[model samples]
Target: MSAQHFVFLLVKNHTHLTLACATEPLRIANMISGQELYRWSYASEDGVSATASNGSVTLVQHGFGALPPCERLFVIPGLGMTDFITAPLLACLRRAKAGGVAVGALCSGAWILAEAGFLDGMKAAIHWEYHDAFAERFPDVALVRSVFVADERHITASGGTATADLMLHLIEQDHGYDLSIAVSDMMVYAGAREATGEQRISLQSRHGMRNPHVARAIAIMRGALEEPVPPGSIAEDLGISVRQLERLFGRYFNTSPSRYYMELRLDRARNLLLQTEMSVSEIAVACGFQSLGHFARLYRKHFGGPPSSQRGRIA
Candidate 1:
């Protein structure tokens, strides 16, 4: 069989991580197979270099108006995506679709596809942070929270490592499980995540609660990580008594609302510690801890180490 051609249509401020993940699988697949199983190139609307979200620039090999015929074309975009979608780019995608070229998107690039009317009546996936806004803007599209959605013609994946998952899925489809596994091993990837996996933890799973009110209350807490509301206020907002809320928490989670909230904040602090360059005190303040001493004490009690020590280990 001939090599499958792919063109990644990049936009300004494209997500560098997603782009790398999406393309690395193909490169690995080719190396493992010792064949040009997949060929890809970067393209831009005006044949210019595109700047990534991290300020990295990618030189384009093709302009949208002068793209080489390809089996698949993927739209990969990043932050400020709403400002990047233009008539010419949408027209190019629409024209490609009309010519029977399979189209896909990574990250918020699905927003451009939806604007082009290709995702109408289709189940699409975008990064979870944009779920509410995308749903509100594209009411006709079925915006799912899965890591990626592989519809008949339009494929969409949420950003980050989800792009890798989608690309691995496609590799398996095009070649076989053995080749896909070989490529994954070469990349040091543990395993490919299923496309149906959720982008975020469900409230029920996070809090181990079945009661709708309790789940809703926890969701509220998650939404207000930096500015926590009181448990009494949470109960009032949920139209339940504070005693009832406490009872629900005690029955299901075996913890009080205050304790659960503190755990959630600590979990966020741990993630920031491992993933970001923010200082311990900044993380404490960001997680809504008023006193750094109290934050350190509770953090050690919860995580079995001081925040400073945790940062040291992570760094």
Candidate 2:
């Protein structure tokens, strides 16, 4: 078999720590093996360079326009993907797929893959904050909320240590536990988890709301995505009046029910913009906004950009 060539599809201002966690284990595995089982190059839309969110510059040798065939391609991205899917990068990923590269995403990179239209109907994982919004955006893609999901081959992982876990899983798959163990020992990763590991918290428990009505209402809202009911309708279903719903939201969130729901819808819009290559009109409809102009207006008010600009930034 040929030596595995791993390539990273990075964007400007990707998270530096994630880049390291994604690549270093492979470097270590090569060191421990005394032979090159994996080799990699960095790629971006252009052949220029990228700065991590923390302000580190990484030089890129290849533009997506000139990338070589590779066994795997991983996209590493940082914040603001909700507004940054550039067409050039999206096309690059699409071309890579047409060339038969196995692709994966990390950190906010899942948003990029979704933007490339690569993650539809697949199960994936991503950072926790974007989970609700991601689900709302890509109804076809199942957001697993795991640290990593390997079965779909559209593998993704939450950032930080989860990035390390993903690289470890790759090492294990290619080189076996001996090399994975050596690299893990070198990295002092006794606490590292496998690809099949679940995310740390349950959704209900994370909310810390013992109040059954609020919990049930959240579930109802989550279920009724295509036809979102107002908090009043949800309240009625929960056996509470709208005034009672207002009190519950105020007590727990310090916000009114209407504002909270709006936030939820807009948040979903943001995720759809980042993760799927769907057009602005498509995303708007998916987020339950009947009017494209209204969706764009609310998106700007909340996230400070129109849908077109947001998608451009992620690329």
Which one is best on lDDT?
A: 1
Q: Per-residue CA lDDT of candidate 2, range 55-113, in tens?
A: 88889989978888899898887877655578777888888888888888888778778
User: What TM-score do all the candidates reach, one by one?
Assistant: 0.70, 0.68
lDDT string, candidate 1, 1-315, tens digits: 899999999988899999999889999999999999999999987898888989999999988887889999999988878778888788889889989999999998888999888888999999876764575468899888899998547999998999999989999999999998888888899857898998887778876656899889888998788899999999999999999999988988889999999998888887667545567888888889989999999999999989887662221
Question: Best-fitting candidate, measured by TM-score?
Answer: 1
Give per-residue lDDT, candidate 1, residue 50: 83
Looking at model 1, report the run of 10 residues with the lowest lDDT sum: 306-315
Name the regions of candidate 2 deviating beyond 4 angstroms: 201-315
Error of 2 at 313 (Å): 12
Assess each prediction's global lDDT (C-alpha) against the native: 0.87, 0.80
